[model samples]
Target: MWQRGAVTDSAPLDVDLALLGGGGAASLVLAALDRHGVRGLRIAVVDPVRRRGQDRTWAFWGHPGSDLDPLLSASWQRVEVATPARRRVLELAPLRYAMLRSGPVYDRAAEAERRLGAIRIGAPAAAVHDDGDRVVVRTGGDGPTVRADWVLDSRPRPPARPGRTTWLQHFRGWWLESDRPVFDPDRAVLMDFRTPQPRRGVSFGYVLPVSDRYALVEYTEFGPELLTDAGYDAALTGYRDLLGLPGDGLRVREVENGVIPMTDAPFPARPTPRVVRLGTAGGATRPSTGFTFSAMYRQADQVARALAAGRAPVPAPAYPRRHRWMDAVALRALDRGSVGGPEFFDRLFDRNPPERVLRFLDGTTSPAEEVAVMNSTRLRPMIAATAGDAAHRVRDRLRPTRPAPAIPAAVVATPTPPPGTGNRST
Candidate 1:
């Protein structure tokens, strides 16, 4: 193993793996690799925000006795889905909804890294390039260069087309506590469409009750809306009014907010030779669901196994070309105003078995299950978009024979607002 704090002025420190981005993907991969007895592999995690105290929660559906169950701090047995036309409560037998808070996850990962003594922290990688044989990662702030046999990049990708169209699904949630039991703590309100739908997209509210008196109430949108603090306050008020909950009497405990990109950009799975992409950067996230934590866990496990066996880390076969095509079709359908935003999902839940549909969303369903999902949707426009995207992809792949244009490193460092923001209705 390389000695800690040892760096030669002109030497690249050789390592097994270097992970970029310290979000859900990086943490999950590190944890899985540690579990598999992959020791003495020089691993370094690079992220601008290394210290974690962020208020974010990830929720996913898992069967009983899943490996993630032990890590969940809170969960729900029942989930509710609602639209203006209908409302349904799914019992979710054999499957439970689970949640993990970011703070605890960071603490656990940091402790594990310290115990293993195989990983390095606080090194924010600036650029990664594949130098024919190995992947070289340049770090910021005079940090030593790390040359790893394999590199996994988990950075979020900007939208493929500038000003094409984008929307941010962002929300702020207030943890409310009431003197008396005000919520059904055992159930999670998945989606309530009582809020007004935007002309260009859709909007809804979600509620997750953690206890008899405490709950997370969130307002979400799938279209453009960069909400100010006052806008979020108004949304909370509107949600309370629609739910018939006492707004004036409720006690506020804590608040959490986040924004997730909803796009159809094809994030490359393999960016360079010997370098693999993980997490959202690798299309692990379902475009329709914005759920990536569980997917990242599964992807990380596959990657760790491959590394242990001396194989290049390719994403699992479950995420085939068909899945990418489906996402592209759906995104185009939404973008072109071919389908009503809420109606599309409403029809999905109303027509298909909830479990099968959820499985498809999780990228765990079989081919037959995927067929069933396709049959449930209106097919003409979706199919057209799929064919068009396929043709475009093929043409682009065949025509790409030119050298990459020179791009200054400073150009990539500029922070811009994520896509989908411009199309949102005020």
Candidate 2:
């Protein structure tokens, strides 16, 4: 049992737990706690802005009967993956690919905060200090100080350690409403590699059709750099032509764009004994594939279980150690030009069953299944990459600590959508 209190002028706002960021991570953690029937805990969620609009889109493949199914904007059991040479349309029987807007999630979180009597601090956390016993969080601009037994910090920060290879999964998507029915709402294109490839890294087109006349078309690239506004728009234009959509009748209702880090850096979850990290900061984003929503849920569930069992609230690893090692090798190969990105991914889906491959990507494959999936890829190059990456790690460990070279401004800039477009952060 815990006591709830309001902020006072003389002392800090004391609570059992403090969430530094009121984004998807904090919300999910709170939901997990509720699911486990954990009660009587005072919680405070601190963030500069509690955005509650349709600011982002989250897509994942899962079996039906999830509580979030009602909030899905679109879902499909059939998906298409294509290359210039061939295309495979897969039917996912037990698993369905789903897209969910952020608005419902934010709305549900707000309702939970009200019902749970949780405090909402609409201020940016300037700093979080774990003082051995209690974690103290200071907010920006003379905001209230929050002291709690545990702190879950989800605020974004640079990686604590440098990785051998890092790539940005950057993209711009446009929500289009057409004058005529053109899209097949039943099928979603996961990756269409018809777009011209960059000198380095891979580029692909993704399409999610919500209706016959409405869809979200995106141009995505996984590389060390981001594209300029004109560059992304130009690629989208070319992709639109390739899809044979009418030129003049398509209306861009909204635009979404963001960058997700795909790296093998060690993002330690427990920064301090009582301070835990969540979201991307806690390594929720998968390095090989920039998928995070499912991983975040898994992390949150672990944290809840720990607390319920009278243990410290610590989230588990988003992916197993062996999985991370495999992702590291894959990233290294992609960065070193040892594997052509399109050909590699094409071979993965073309040679293996879609269910096995998708499960492997989500880090749920058994050891034998994983071996089979690995066998489907070009084994020689991957084996060479494994050896090279291992040698590099050994060399790095023996060398003195050095700061990573600064990335170029053009390479790390947050992509901006074209003029006259509303933006959503993902």
Candidate 3:
């Protein structure tokens, strides 16, 4: 528990790097720094809240040999996907779908921090400024202005409004334990699109069962607006009824809820010379699938490598240009109603081998494998999204460009972010 303190600015504490927000991304960096045994560098991670519990769950399909793989809670060899008219079960050979709870991973990072000696502050960063040689970050409530050689801001981006070229993968889930054995402990439902669809968006349900009687089930939407609490409750009720998990016999244990930005809006990893955006804000989340863990892990390695080499870090993207291009295309199609989620997903799964599709989604496919996956998609959405992208590029080329107005030093002010400013689900 944290308490409000007197707004007194303290003396400067110097460090090699300061992580603005201590969440999964910061933890990954701490773990990496520890693994590399990088010495003579001080580090600190500051966040207002203690990021405890299973705040979120991340699922991905991979070969599972990373340092974090040992923290995996559950994995499945076979996964199922359903549409209104079709059901498909994919057997993932060489790669399996896996889940990791945040608790153990958080604990592991805590252990790693013993080496780096990074402090996690319980306050929001008010503002960050690149002061030529170093970046100065001021926290709210007159908290000590943390100065470091570099800053990585993992704060969630602002909310989306009308007129943005973005979609949201919003979800609400319940962890349930049933009196009767009602779940397949060995399998996971990738997506069940039998749920009632919104007027203009796609919706689905997922089930990850840990036991015959325990599972985390949720309804998700890739749409314009997030579902209300009541709406999510109704969807969950329908899913339970469909699965024949009775109301009286089922006990809801806990709930998880979040919204992830699905966009191609230019998210430059570095917003300032001394500060680099990390995690989802830095474009780690896959725009199409809303996955982030694997991408963030790759990014951590990139940043750690640059620091070890004693070079100014210009972290490479976790995705290739082609991967980003395809992501933009898919998002555009979904936004334009040219793509229906159930059918779009079904086509990819039904036409391509599961490994190939997973590889494509993971952004690890070769050019040839990419071509094969593109061949499986509906051509109309591809054409539409491609045309839109081309038009935007041409418009930019033809239009006049101007430099951004500079902020005068006399009038500069950095406001404290409201609590949980950059908060987003992984």
TM values, all candidates: 0.85, 0.93, 0.88
Q: Name model 3 segments beyond 4 Å from true.
A: 1-9, 158-164, 396-426
Query: Can you write out model 3's per-residue Cα lDDT over 111-188, one digit (the tens) per residue?
Result: 777666666556789888897699988887646777899888777754222212567778877778888898998889
Ranking by lDDT: 2, 3, 1
Q: Per the 3 Å backbone cut-off, how many clashing residue pairs does candidate 1 have? A: 4
As a whole number from 0 to 100, the lDDT of residue 208 in candidate 2 is: 98
For 77-179, candidate 2 gives per-residue lDDT tens digits of 9999989998889998788999987778777777777666787777788888888899989887756888999999887766766778989888888888899
- Model 2 regions lying over 4 Å from their true place: 1-10, 403-426
Q: Among these predicted structures, which one has the highest lDDT?
A: 2
Q: After superposition, how far is residue 86 of candidate 2 from its true place, in Å?
A: 1.2
Clashing pairs in 2: none
On the 0 to 100 scale, the lDDT of residue 103 in model 3 is: 77
Candidates 2 and 3 compared: the better one by TM-score is: 2
Stretches off by above 4 angstroms in model 1 are: 1-12, 159-166, 380-426
